[model samples]
Target: MTIGLMLNALGAGVGATTVDATARDTPSASSFGIGAAIWVLISNLIGLAVGAYVAARLSGTSDNTDGTLHGLAVWGTTFLISAVLLGNLVAGIASTAATSASSVLGGVVRGAGSAASAASNVAGPGGLQSATQGMVDRVQRALSGGGSPASMTSDQRNAEMATLATRWVTDGRMTASDRERLNALVAAEYNIPVQEAQQRVQQAEQQAAEAVRRAEETARQAADTAASGAATAGFAIFGIMLLGALAAVFGARRGTRDVLLVRGTGNVR
Candidate 1:
């Protein structure tokens, strides 16, 4: 196991140097692609096989079955240990990342010199008064109904219609009174007849419904595509693992040294 890990580390070192050779040149995208993956896979396979052979040979078992089993045991034990270490590493990284932002913020707040920087711009002079005044202005405007709907500017007319349309979409259907008001707002804002306003509202509603349907369909297709990719990756991983097991068995079997009995070897054949 130690031998295999050492070999893997050596290979990784070599690969790191090879891939980083462009450091002095113009920066480019990573050269680590399918070829890098293949290299890692092949190197790992060799390590496992070599480790398994060493394990079988060291066990002093001349039987092929025992040798193969010994190799398998080595492979399994190595993988189990690796999985535990990987899990711990992953957990540590995740925990640190999750807390890093909060930790920095907490540190900044605890430090007197950094506390001012940590605070929001809302703490500046007149910030509170300005924010409160803005809120009061919005409230007053809402209460005033922004003046009569018909007397509004073009931008105001468009904004009022958009707000009403949003409410209609949220409510799933506009009430008869709301629809009547919308038709009047549309007629006044667009300077069109009531009939045309009603037709425009119908068209907008249909278009919104169609957009929602298309969005739903797109989400479903994306989900299916992701599921398919996951399945393919799972199968590929399974095949690679199976191949590694086979390699371990082969290496172990081949490592079974030929043992001859003293009495039988008396002929020196």
Candidate 2:
């Protein structure tokens, strides 16, 4: 199985490189295709067959059944070993990808935290008697409602916005109540007319919708690629295993016949 895996990997690499070079100028250039899959299947089948044949020949069995069993054992042992190694490799890759994604998300969170800290510290040593306080006083005068988000500290405002954005993403749209609150906050903070605030909200909504559409499309393409790869792998595995079994049986039969012929010839002599 080890030999088979090595040959399959080498053949796949060469085949993919060759295909890529040949299709370099083509619009539909792709390294993966039916040809590549077939090549991998054939390489593995040949390797496993060769291994099985060698085992049968070395077993020195006159019985075809015994030789066949030995060949089957070889194929089974190699397959198990390969499966364990491949499984570990795949697990390692998945773990690394997950860790990288988490790290990126954590960095974004940390950046947001730093920005909020900077906003809060704009008051400097003057405490509440700073420029930030002046802005707060103006916001209080602008907002008629006591629940204006403009009165929130920068960190609180950031947290609220994050929560709203999360809700929009999860629900696929902003609720009317959330939109109204957001519009009120925007109008109070920017000292804009209600109509202009509504327009701004509408534009933000459109942009968010576009972003969601793009994310969905990207996810769909990734899923399609994964599905195609999985289907191809499944077919290759089935074909290779079947071919390996047949090759081993044939090799065993030939080995047994040769051994019996040699023994009979010796008896006659």
Candidate 3:
């Protein structure tokens, strides 16, 4: 049982490494392989000795039957020991990693959403609103000593918006209908035409700003998930090996005793 438990742990570790590496498309997925192997070897050796000693003591007769029983005892105890000690450890670590990953994923999604929303604020029913908003945001972004959104001069804000609207119209981001709508809204708000409205707002600013935010958010989320998965897998493997050792130890003792009894009765019969 002890040997079996050790083998089981080793096999499980290998399987986990293979699966993780394949899934992640990374070559270093099994970086902890050496550590896991070493733990198994050392712990199993100890379990084997303990199991053999216990089995010998339990067997009343020193015969071939008893010898066989001892072997079984050693195996069983090894498994039991490994399982109890390692299982809990692995579970705790894996849980922590999973939690971390979840947190990272949530943060990334929230960041992305916020960026999209910020860009959307500049867009209006007509291209005019979006153009105007883009200009205001850019000027505000560029201010020295960073005062407030209200700090930009009205003329500077107007010039920026007009530049943005023209760019939006030319870039195919806005259509004729969009321009017309923008003009109507501008005329209603400031008695200006669609052309004049275009001069008031900018287009490239909106797409550029949103794009940058989206990229950053995506990268952060990916990194968080990767780190979490690595931690979880390492802890889970450690726990499994420890538990397996425990199972092997206790199990070996019982098996050995049963075998000895069977042999003794057989010899008498």
Candidate 4:
């Protein structure tokens, strides 16, 4: 029993890790498709042999229990243990999947930033070009101060404009020129008249926020599916190994009985 347990634990750990690492998006040093196939064959064979031998010896009864039964027990134990451990070990990584998704989004944002810069340079004077670099500096500062004009979901940017406009109107803090410019920014951002632009911004913002939430949910489902498949495959392999071991044990016992009969002169010359 002890030997069977140890062999199974060791095999499960190595097998599960190999499967998990190869399952990632990163390139693997090993030819995982081919290597996994070959390793699975050899590992199953080795596990079967060791498990059957240990089970036969520890079955510890001479009451003529079937060798196949003992062998099946060995395989069943291995499969159950592997499934439990692999599932538990992988649970933590499931939660971190969102972090990987966020990184992908960040890459997309960087690509968009480069495109925006190039387009700005191409448009030159008519590109809604800032009168001076200092104006660009102020926009950058406002964004850097945690109010990114570009990062806002369409609705968020709309909400931001509404708040700004409300302050301009209600607080009497803006010069007429500032309100006009603010109105123009909102128009350019939403592509509508100042009043209509505000409503469109609100709608777009709501839609963009909903889209992001849906995307995150989709990502979570994909991650869960991948994890579940790996675990199921692992358990399936363990079961196959057990079946093979039982066949080996039965063959061994039959061979032993046949040898004894032949040696007793039942059919020997």
TM-score of 1: 0.69
RMSD of 1: 5.6
Quick one: best lDDT, which candidate?
Answer: 1
Tell me the tens digit of each residue's lDDT in model 3 across 171-257: 847666545544444444565665765565334446656876898899999999999999998886677655544554444444443
Over the stretch 1-269, how does candidate 4's per-residue lDDT look in tens digits? 34445655665566556655455754365665555556555555566566665566565533335555676666667667877888987886875787888899999999999998888788686654665566777655444422444455555455556666576547645566545555555775665778875565456547756876899999999999999999999997767665666655663343222212245556563
For each candidate in the order shown, give its overall lDDT on alpha carbons.
0.77, 0.74, 0.60, 0.61
Best by TM-score: 1
Error of 3 at 171 (Å): 32
Candidate 3 residue 155 C-alpha distance from true site, Å: 34
lDDT per residue (tens digit) for residues 1-269 in model 2: 66667887887677645544465752233435666667766776677677777888888777778888987887787778878989999999999999999999999999999987886677466764677678887665443343656675544444455566678879888999988877766666677887898899899889988987999999999999999999998996887777878876766666553542335745842
Among all windows of ten consecutive residues in candidate 1, which has the lowest summed lDDT? 26-35
Rank list by TM-score: 1, 2, 4, 3
Q: Report the CA-based lDDT of candidate 1 relative to the real structure.
A: 0.77
Residue-level lDDT of model 1, residues 139-160, one tens digit each, is 5554443456677666666666
Off by over 4 Å in 3: 1-43, 80-92, 122-269
